[model samples]
Target chain A: MIVAVIALGLLAGASGLLLGFAAIRFKVEGDPMVEQIDAVLPQTQCGQCGYAGCRPYAEAIAAGEADINRCPPGGQNGIAALAELLGRDPKPLDPESGIEKPKMAAVIDEQSCIGCTLCIQACPVDAIVGAAKHMHTVIARECTGCELCLAPCPVDCIHMIPFAPSITTWKWTYPAVEVKAAA
Target chain B: MSALFPFHGGLKTVRHKTESNQTPIQAGILPPRLTVPLRQHIGAIAKPLVQPGDRVLKGQMIGQPDGYISAAIHAPTSGVVSAVDQQPVPHPSGLSDLCVTIESDGEDRWIDREPVDYHRLHPSELRQTIRNAGVVGLGGAGFPSAVKLNLAGRSEPLATLMLNGAECEPWITCDDRLMRERAAEIVAGLQIMAHLLGPAEVLIGIEDDKPEAIAAMTAACAGTSYEVRPVPTRYPSGSVKQLVKLLTGRETPVDGLPVDVGVQCFNVATAYTVYRAIHCGEPVISRVVTVTGQVHRPGNLEVLIGTPFAELIKQCGGYRDGVERLIMGGPMMGFALHSDEAPVTKAANCLLAAGPAELAAELPVLPCIRCGACMDVCPANLLPQQLYWHARAKEFDQARDCHLFSCIECGCCSHVCPSHIPLVQYYRYAKNEIWAQEKEKQRAEQARQRHQARMERLEREKQEREAKLRQKAPVRTEVVPHLDPLISVPSPTKGEGSGQVG
Candidate 1:
């Protein structure tokens, strides 16, 4: 009995030592899971998910404090990707967050812009460029269509326009296949 | 027949060549107005050189090549620029693009022509000249020929320079007629390409269906060290990768080009253009187009670029009775045109006005029974069924893993499928979706980086503002050490009360 106990004890102690060594040798620097989740989330920085930005939402997701469906800008595909990554069942996006919409470009009515710099300060991606008291303009390419600048505009000059697919941006749609009715 | 290496899974489709190749290529009449698209070749669109009101000479550079991979555009005839505006161009999608409309002035005036000696000029300079001449692959790809002539990233010793005279797509006889007529000029162009590449062997692969072309090309290559080998007639044998394999026995890497296998291939028509550019100092203002299908005269015509399709069709006696579709290319890989009003770009090799008899019967698409027929006919040797399934399910990543981009969209699988499934369409859709997703990911990465930079800048600005305020506020803070403790805890209520009292 004592020999068996001693052998078991040595085996357990050896494994423990190996694991302890591995913990230090392969120590991860930071929360890499957060980074992975952040990569899956579209970095719109819209703050529709009740978080400051996509990164914070990703952090909350990593901490299990936020649901994956909260990212409306990310859409159903993003939720599916997150679910696949986290090994969870995919769910529909939360309606309270906002419904998925077509890609939009924020356009500023330049004539109506008061030059107050409110929209510039409110822009998350700094796509709006202008000096203080100068007429501000939105860089259409850089604007994420986040609609973050709309609420901050005192003169209500900011407008979100749906981007129409041009020849370069247009893509071929799925081929129509005839579905047979089940007998 | 030589011992040629065969590629996998090709079709033995019906050849509609005899209908078009019997007659000699005729010169097309100049239309009243020519609308040339800025984006003829694949790359950045050429920048407009003249405004709407400016007069342009025939062969004058109207659109300058914008980037390294772009090709220049020239006026087909001397005329005033009528309008530089958006118009319908010949595309699979009936969308409009920026076009340079020129009103033809009866006199086909020429720009000053300076023919350069290719032997004396450097290869790079020659390539630049070819690019300036707007010469592109006339095998329906429309890629800038000079870009392909460049041997920049190639590391291996050049093995073979294969000229594709295959004209493998059924109903397209432009290359065949060019080979039969202008063999010597095409050979001259091949020599220039060989001088640039320095390949060990120069080969020409023509489909066996065109015997006259083979004899012509062979006779033209008599004194030169160029071989004209006739490959067995097969659909898509004209594709770059397949032709490379068939002629040189080198299978191009799946995600790579023909150059990766130490081979450079060009269409015979492209060679002819190269010869014209260097020997005659002519830019690519015209190309031989096969006006076949339901047209009254199903023959080849050397139509000028920017000529309206309707005019060219009218030159061929217009559309016949029961004209069903106006296709831009061969029936296999071509797309239906909504209107013949679209101008013919450099890529318009064949404007097939397909009748009801020429088109495949509209069969209803059915479910796949896992029949390996599609796999048996795919030229790229990919499993089309699985690709179709993944694409249908929107499982793009899985489709990509199945080597979706390797598919050349040759439509061989679709042609052979018993279920009548549009397999190539699914593949095209999947490829486009993947490209769109990649572009979105790149945009997102850019946004993230900009956001981070903006945050850092704001933080830095706040710190600088605080430092400036501190600097402006006094050295007296350090003078009284006892006051620091009291100042650290601000009594906001007392201060507000004192301000109210004041």
Candidate 2:
């Protein structure tokens, strides 16, 4: 038993040491590019992209996997600048994606409200605050400005109004087209 | 074909070609008018050379080429420029863009023409002349042919010039008709392209479904160093990349072009146009378009560019009863036309006037059942179900890690989705969302910079104010009060917000 114990102990010690050395030797270098991309991404966590979160999208951008134009929430400017970062020709927001328009959130017109919370159920991000057969109001700040709530209201009580652009939410316009650099 | 180079994974899509491909392509009678869009070719929108109230000859140039990458617009029939403003264009979005409307004088007269013996001219001179003739890809891609032919001189070392006759799209039969009717001209164009690229072997890749085209190409290419290779009809088989791989045994790396693989492919129609441009000195003014789907009498018609969809439909015997979806091009990857009034452009290959009985109406999208159907048919080897999930959930980052950008939006995912979900639409949505977020961030940075500059200006003003106050005291022996009554001294407030360095 003692002999077997010593052999196991030696094996464990060797493996532990090797693992420790590897951990020390191969530390990951975080890229500033990822951080820059992350700063650009809208952190709505809408999961509109296949990624788990916005950070993964940023990481993908840094890795040259994600196109800048994929973000509906980020809109046109996001794609243009992403084209800037990747040093590729900036194409218009692919029409395959829906055209970019001013953002608006669903506003429940209380007077027309039949107290049917159908709009509440349709709210993907759960920005609606109301009860069944009672008046509903939208939490504007939490809304992703998707306007999904407008469709479900049977009586058309829910109306979409344009959201004001804030300093924190604004983006730079696409730069003028220039000759492409060698990748 | 070598087993190592065999192309695979193609879907047997429904063919609605009986409506159009059965009849031989007919030349259309002269129309009352035509509306030519300046940006007909691949490059920038050409500048308008003729204005309204100006009379033009049949071959008059209306829109001049913007740059080397662009093609010029020509008058299809002798006409007067009625309008050169925004008109409804046949795009998926149904938006209005700049167009030149010409009212035909009904006299189909050709201007005194000049022809060039391309065999005697140098390759560079031939290419420049082809550009001047406004020859471009008659294929759906619409890339300037002169620009593509010029790439032969690049050190990439091209080995083959392929004539793509694989009209794989369900309803479009333009390329097939071009090969069937104008095979010799296409061959002449191929020889011209081969001369430019020198001793480059020509391979005409036609789908097996188009045996007539294959036979015609074979007969036309009998005396030359060209081979007509029949490939299996596949959705996207006509795509330049897939055709190249099928013919030359080369795979173009992602984001790289067919030229990178030592192979260059052109549409059979484009090749025929090059022949016409080189030999007859005739610029591309018209093309063959397949009018099919729910129309009463459907067939291919050689129509002039900028002719309204209404006119084409009228020539095709109009729509039958409840014509629902009007798609420009094939059902697989075509854009839905917004209205019947929109004029057809160079990119339009087919106009599908689908009714409820012929084409199914868009059904309500259900949750994905994870049946793995999307994966089985994805040409790009992507997990479309995962992409749909991320797109629905707005998890664009995860989609990116899964190579979302590589999803070519070919509509295969949407086509095969058992859930009836418009998967392509979702992917597009995800892409747009990600783009919007990036733009928002950029705007914020710009705003921050502007705010910073304003803060700096305020600081400088405060500093100057203090300096003046000190100077006044120094000049007035520490107790002197007023000097100039015209200027009143105002004290500054202390509250200054710190700026974020952009």
Candidate 3:
């Protein structure tokens, strides 16, 4: 009985040592939970979530310093997803962030652009490209419609426009009644 | 007759064929204005060739095929282009799209035409000619026929080429009339298909209800090796997969084409158009559209592609009293059109001017009782209740797991539901949402990649700036003796240096 007990004890001790070594050998620098939270974020970098960017907001959420309902662009669906991930009850979006709206992109009026580069500096995602004293243009697909660059634009050239639905983007609307009527 | 295979589920709904088919097919009167939407087929919308005030002859190309999967668009009659702008199209969305409006000159003038010997041309060239001719599936799906014909390029040897003539939808006799009146032309087209695909057998499946159509087609196919097989009259038997199953016992793999199973199918009307294109050197400028339901003179009309639906209704002696809705296509899978101002496109098969009695009264929808009635009538063998449940809950992934794409939107499930749930609509909603979600996900992924790339680019620039500063420090020290001490001072440590530099 004593020999079997000793063997079990040694096995446990060896496994513990191996685990400790592994932990030190492959230590990850950042909190993996924060990365996961950031992944769930809409990544708009809108800063309406009471944080500087999506990653910072995710870090705050991971640390329990911020609420999950802070993101307006992610809206209710985002909260639900985060809640499911964290095993928390889903909550309604906090109204201070803003209401959900269709995706919009910043369009710069080339004629009105004064080449101040203020809008370029304001973009967090580096979606704007220009040199000082040169006209700036937004890389439309890259722009997250965060509206961060709007306030900095002196010329008011940048306009947030909703995407127009084309034939490729068109979807069928739900039918009302449930009866077969010959057309 | 060959032994027929039974499909999973179908409805024996009232066949209202006689309401319109009692009279022969009529030639549609030319409307004053024709507003043709460039996107008639399923692929890329045709690019406009004519501007406002430009004169075009009948059958002249107005919209050229943009891509390999696109079909060409032609003017229905000799006309002067009035406008090329957004107009109401015959779509369920009721949204306006780019349309080419033309004012007909009433002359119906023809452009210079030359018939091409399809046999003399190369196979690729022939397919291109057909694509240029704007031939597409006339059986509602409107898939470009040229793409469908290029099955020979696949590794799988072609086995069966089935021609669908089963006008199973009620009150739509366009295909029926086409078969009865122009069976020989359809056979000629079928011969061309046979030569292109070189299948082992050519089978034509027709519903047993139309004996005259069957006899006419049978007579037309007597000399050739093609066989006209009449299947049982069941609703939705005309659907591609169902018709394929009824004719041949082969089951098409889920999310796979009929060509995957060594079989390809085409509608009888598509074949007739192919014949016209090859023999008469014509593009698809017109088609036989059935104008039935609550009209003084209900019959099939050979309508032009760009003719307005309002004009076609007028040709049918106008609307009767108490017309509740105007539907496009058959009742089983048709959509309610908001306006008669919409123009007829290539996909239009039937237009129903339905009255209140004909349409099901707006009844209050009850919750599903789980009666399994919808399950029994699903031709695709999908559990509609489960799809409806998941779809209603917006759990699209779960619906997808249940093979949601297999549901052909046949409306059989909706027809059999005691709950009066628009099950097909729910499925459609779910599908569209899933598609939209997928597109959003793709866009998000692209944005993430771009963000990462920008971050990398910034990091690289910062490193290059630091390296340039380190290299220039010694040079500056040598040039100025008094400032040598400040310039030659050793750089700060790596961590502090980057922070100080910024």
Residue-level lDDT tens digits of model 1 in B241-276: 999889878889989989888888999999998998
Chain A TM-score values, per prediction: 0.93, 0.56, 0.82
The ten-residue window of minimal lDDT in model 2 chain B covers: B493-502
TM-score of 3: 0.91
Q: Which of the predicted structures, 1 or 3, would earn the higher lDDT when compared with the native?
A: 1
Best of the two (1, 2) by TM-score: 1
Reference-based TM-score of each model: 0.95, 0.67, 0.91
Residue-by-residue lDDT tens digits, candidate 3, B1-502? 7799989999998888988887788988889899999999998889999999999999899999998888899999998999999998988878888889999999999998778888898888888888888999999999999999997559867999999999899889999999999999999999888888889999999999999999999999988999999999998899889988898988899999888888899999999999988888988999999998998888999999989899899999999998989999988888889799999999999999999866766666787888999999999999999999998888989999999999999999988887788899899999998998887767666666665655665676666667667766666656875753554434434453232111
The regions of model 1 sitting more than 4 angstroms off are: A181-183, B481-502
Model 2 sits at an interface RMSD, in angstroms, of 18.6
What DockQ do you compute for every candidate structure? 0.46, 0.03, 0.34
Best by DockQ: 1
- Give candidate 2 misplaced runs (Cα > 4 Å): A1-183, B1-4, B431-502
Give the winner by lDDT: 2 or 3. 3
Q: State model 1's lDDT.
A: 0.89
DockQ of 1: 0.46
Question: Which clashing pairs does model 1 show?
Answer: none
Candidate 2, what DockQ? Answer: 0.03
Q: Which sequence of candidate numbers ranks them by lDDT, best first?
A: 1, 3, 2
